[model samples]
Target: MSRRRHENFRELLSKREGFTVSQVSFQNEVLEAHNYYRDLHCAPPLQLDNKLSRSAQIFAEELASKNQFYHSNTKGVGENLYMASGSNVDSLTGKLSSNQQISSSFSYANIAGDAPVTDWYNEIEQYDFDYPGFSGATGHFTQVVWKNSKNLGVGIAYTSEGDSVYVVAQYTPPGNYQDQFPDNVFPEGQC
Candidate 1:
């Protein structure tokens, strides 16, 4: 048994025939030992196991945005209201918001493509509200009703962490939700 063990050891050394095993070779020896030991006892390999082996360094970053546009009482007639969000979101390496103003709601649906998130003010918008009549209602506030509505929308984006990338799915809505437009005809919501 001792002779057989000696022969096995010699066989491993002979397998590297004509190769120089210098002090630097110690690193390779340790790695070889670890690989062989791990093959028998380690956990299952991960998806990125060998993919990053050749790269000197790997890095990743994640970014997100919760862009919103909201407004109230922009006009006197019908008390038009507008709200929208996340118009033309795009891929990038950092966080950002639409260049339009949250207080600017009347411009919904008017903005052209390639505009900043802020430019969302150009879009056409509408809202629903109930008003009360008052005898002393000299100022507009006397008959005004203050209210806020919740909107929801859904979108997709790519996120990264460490050396991994993930696809993120989300839902969102316009800033103000309106359903009282009896004249508004569409299969669902238009656009």
Candidate 2:
């Protein structure tokens, strides 16, 4: 492991909860063991909507009228091996088709459809999110390719009735927001 790279990761790990840095360096290989983790993709960004109405004028009105609480979170793993395995992999060329991760939005409502979508999660659907326990957490996240190519990805997920909502807008800086390293991620492919 390169000494510079190893030190860089060790410093990053120090910021996580319960991380303790050892004043003594060469004595232990524990810090060196974490080198490989540097290659893993960084976690997706979490942007909280201060107002639910920002999703879209019509969609927002539908949400407020129902007296339901709706929350949306998106995550895009630049290169998803699990999802890509299903199709479109040109092994001959190093350029593999990147895939998006699963992102879900759930609402707190007695009447599922009443959350305004009225039949979204139940009817006009693309993929059903079924996992035993976490019922409310069901939605689709976007996919971002790490490659240096111009590509546009559209992710529209609401449910069989209305499981998720996507709202696009320029982010107004929040007072408490901690911008991740290098803006969105850790120096992109370098990290």
Candidate 3:
């Protein structure tokens, strides 16, 4: 993977290929990713009436107003009410409300495209294991966010860690979740 700090989405876009680089004009990746995740998990499509829709617009405004936004790409992209997290989420990624409700949720902002893994299946084919996540991890993913008053925001996930990149979008409401388990023993929740 490239060691140079991405600084901002613009800088990051410049490093990517297959799309015209622009903060405002370049949204295919965002839309595609959102759609892909939405369908895979069968989540609701973007609703104009939802509060998250407005949040997305304000985020775009903030990004456009900036002269040159810069951020680090070393860490994976994520956000939580208390602290952003990865694998250790169930441990320390949320803040329960006075009513004992978890106040934060996660959603993929972008996810469209297919990176054929079979193409990488070559005993004799050399691989670029150093490319971001792993060898044969084709395609790209990204995101840009702006939090509300408490305003906790996170940038796109710049990683080569998927089989494809379609069905992506730019906004996801907090608290939304997917039903990953039907027979799960845990009390019936969004899981």
**Which has the greatest TM-score?**
3
Cα TM-score per model: 0.13, 0.17, 0.23
lDDT of 3 by residue, 99-145 (tens): 43211111122211111111111211332222222222221111111
Candidate 2 or 1, higher lDDT: 2
How much is the lDDT of residue 13 in candidate 3?
Answer: 45
Model 3, poorest ten-residue lDDT window?
Answer: 141-150
How far in Å is the alpha carbon of 137 misplaced in model 2?
A: 19
lDDT of each: 0.21, 0.23, 0.25
Judged by lDDT relative to the true structure, which candidate is superior, 1 or 3? 3
Quote model 1's TM-score: 0.13
On TM-score, the stronger of 2 and 3 is: 3
**TM-score ranking, high to low:** 3, 2, 1
Q: Model 1: residues >4 Å from true position, as ranges?
A: 1-116, 123-147, 157-191
Best by lDDT: 3
Model 3: CA > 4 A from native: 1-21, 47-172, 176-191
